[model samples]
Target: MTQDSRQSVYERITATIAAAIEAGAGDFRMPWHTDGTMSAHPVNITTGKPYRGINTIALWAAAQGAGYGSAIWGTYRQWAACGAQVRRGEKAALVVFWKIDEREEDAGDMDDGQSDPRRRVLARGYPVFNAAQVEGYTPPPLPALPASARIAHAERFFAALGVTVREGGTRACYIPARDEIRLPPFAAFRDPIAYYATLAHEATHWTGHPDRCARELKGRFGSESYAAEELVAELGAAYLCADLGLACEPRPDHAAYVASWLTVLRNDARAIFTAAAQAQRAADWMHARQPFAA
Candidate 1:
C-alpha cells in the first residue's frame, strides 16, 4: 500500500472504533470484551491463526458490534475456500496486515542514516466477514460456563508472581510507591472470575512499577499517560485471562478512561500499536514470573 492508503487505513479503523465507543456509551460493551470463549483472540477461519496488534482491536470491535459469538472471521475469497459463503447484506470487517518487500539496494545496509533501500514496510488492509456473517460455516458453539468455576488455577498462577498482594479493601488498585497490590476480600466479589480478573488487572499494573518493568506509571488518574497505562493493563489482563482460560469482561469502571484512550488514538493513529506492544511486554513480564507451568 502507498503512504496515502496507509493513512486511510488508520483513519478508517479509528473511525470505526470511535463510532462503536459512541454507540456503546451507556452499555460499555464493545471491543476489549470476552464472554464464554474465555478471552480467545479473534482468529481467521481460513488460516486458523489469531490476529495480532491493532487488527485484534479492530476485529473485536467489529464482532462485538455485530454480536458475533464465534471468533472466526475470514475474507470473502478465504470464506469461499473454507466452503463458507458470506450472507448477502452482511458487511465485512476491516483487517490490516503488514507486508514487507525487498528491492535492489546499495552495498551498505544503511544510507545517510536511513533504512536500507532494499526493504520497505507497507500497511495493507482487507475486508473480513465473521462466522456469523458466513452462511455455511457453523462454528461449534462454545459451551456456556456458569459464573461459578474453579478460579483456583488463576489464583495460584497470580499468587506465584511474587508481587505483594494485600486483601481487605473496597477498591482494587496497584501502588507504585511500594510496588503493592490491594484488593477487597475475595468474598466481596460476586464471582470468583471477577475477583481473579480484577486481581489480574492490578497485577498487570504492578508489573509496571518503577522497580520492575518501569513503565510511565506516574501519570495522574485522568492524564493521557494514565489512560495509556490503563489500556496497557487492560490488554495485559486480557492476555493473561486468555492464557488462564478466564472470561476477561470489560469493567464498567473503565468507561471513564475510554474517552481518554479515544483522544490519544485520534490524535496519534499509531497510539494503539504502542499500547498493544506495551501490553504484550506487561503480560510477558507477568508470565515470566509464573512459578511453573500449571
Candidate 2:
C-alpha cells in the first residue's frame, strides 16, 4: 500500500477500536466455563475465578471505575488489537494485546500468563511504533509530540502535587500507597518529553484515594464499572496531557470492557459527563498543589 493508503488504514483501525471502547463493547470476556457457566473475566490482569453473573459484572465494573478511573486499559495508543474466538456453547473468549516497543531479553524464557515483562520496560514517550511486523499490519506515524514549554511546566506542576519526576519513558503514573508519590525508574521513562505527560496520569489516580478526592476506586479488573473508571482516568490524563502538549497514551486493556462502559454511559449520559468533570477537577487539584519556583 502507498504510505498515505497505509496511514488511512491504520487510522481507521484505531478509530474503530476507540469507538468500540467508548461504547463499552470490549472490556471483559464472557468465558464459557466447564460446568455450564458463563462468567466475566477481566482482560487486564487476569484473576483466578470468573465473575458469576451480570450483577457481579456490573459491581466489578463500578468498583474498577471508582479506583482506576474510567478506562482499564490505560490509553488509546497502547491498544494493539482485539479479536474473539468462539469456545463451546454460548460463550466466547476475547483477546487483546497492548503495543510494546521495547523487547526484553528475558521474555523468551518466561512462562505464559506471568506478569508481562514489557510492562517493566519503561515507555520512552508517545508514538513509539509497534512496527508492521509486531502488529500484523502497517501503522501510521506516531502521534505528534505536544509543545515543550507546556510539558516542562506540567512537570513542575506535578512535582508540586508530590509526584517525583523522572525522564525518558512512556507516560505512566501510579499512586504508591506508601510513598508520597514515586515516579517509576528513570529507565522506564524512555524519553525526556513524556515525563510530565505520565506524571499527569498518576496524579489523576492519586486524586481518587481517601486522603485526596476519596473516589470509590475499587473494582474487579475488566468489569463494566472498572471500564468506566478507566475512562475517567484516561480522559483526565488526556485533558491534562493536552494542556501540557503531550499525546494521550493508549489503553489496550480498555478493549476488553468497552462494551460495558458504553452501556453504562448510554444508560446515563449525564454520568459520563459528570465523571469527566470530576476527573478534570482532580487533575486541576493536583496541578494546584505544586510549589511555585523560587
Candidate 3:
C-alpha cells in the first residue's frame, strides 16, 4: 500500500471508533461492550482465527454499528472460497494488514549497520463482510456456559496467571510499585460478571509492569498518556471478557475517561491503533499464562 493509503487506513478506523465512542457517550456504552448476544471478539470465518489489535477494534465498531450478532467475518475472496457470497448491496467493513518489506543489501553478517537497508512495516486495508452480510454460510453456534461455570473458568484463568490480587478494596486498581492488583470484594460488585470485568481491567494494568508488557506506568498519572493507558486497559478488559465468554459492561468509573480518550483520538489518528495494539499485547500476555495456551 502507498503511504497515503496506509495513513488513510489508520485515519478511517480511528474516525470510526471515535464516532462510536461519541455516539455512546450518553450512556457510557463503548463499541467493545457486548450485550451477551454478539460475540465480543471478531473472527474470520474462513481462517477461524480472531482478528487482533486495530482490526479487532475496527470490526467491533462495525459490528456494533450494524447490529451484527455474528462475530464471523471474511474478505470478499475468502467468502467466495468458502462457497459463501456477500449480499449484492451489503457494505464491507475495513480491516488492515501490517506486512514487513524485507528488501535489503547483503552485509555478510557483519556488525556494520550501514550495510543493510532498514525494513519497513507497511499497512494495507482490506474490506470484509460479516457472516450476517453473506449468504450460504451458517456458523455453528457455541452454547453459552452457565453462570457458575463461567465464574469458575474465570477464577481458574486468574489463578493460572498467578498475579497477586487482593480483594476487599473500595477502588479497583493496579499498584505499579507493588506490582499487584487490588479489587473490591466480590460481594461489593453488582454481580459476578462485574467483578470479573473489573478484575480483567486491573489485570490489563498489571501487565504494564516492567517485568511484563513494560508500558509507561510509573509517572503518567493525570496526563494524556494516563488516559491512553486507561484506554488500553479498557480495551484489554473487553477483549478478555469476549475471549472468556463473559458479557462486558462499562464500568461506572470509566465514564470520566471517555472525554480524555476522545481528546487523545482527536489529536492523533494513530492513538487508538497504538492503544489497541498495546491492549492486545497485554491480553496476549495474560492468555499465554493459561495452561491450555500453545
Looking at model 1, the pairs that clash are none
RMSD in Å for candidate 2, one decimal? 19.9
Error of 2 at 161 (Å): 0.9
Stretches of candidate 2 exceeding 4 Å from the true structure = 1-148, 164-176, 179-184, 217-224, 251-257, 291-294
Q: RMSD of candidate 3 to the true fold?
A: 5.6
lDDT of 2 by residue, 104-199 (tens): 321112211223665642211111111111223322233444355555666566656764444333434454555344565655655654555556
Could you tally the backbone clashes for each prediction? 0, 59, 0
Error of 1 at 110 (Å): 22
Task: Give the Å error, residue 219, model 1.
Answer: 12
Give the TM-score ranking, best first: 3, 1, 2
Please report how far candidate 2 places residue 193 from its true position, in Å: 3.5
Give the number of the best model, judged by lDDT: 3
lDDT of 1: 0.72
| Residue runs of model 1 more than 4 Å from their true location after superposition | 38-40, 100-120, 141-150, 210-212, 217-223, 288-294
The lDDT values for all models are 0.72, 0.41, 0.81
Candidate 3, superposed: residue stretches over 4 Å from native: 36-38, 101-117, 217-222
For model 2, state the Cα shift of residue 130 in Å: 34
TM value for model 2: 0.43
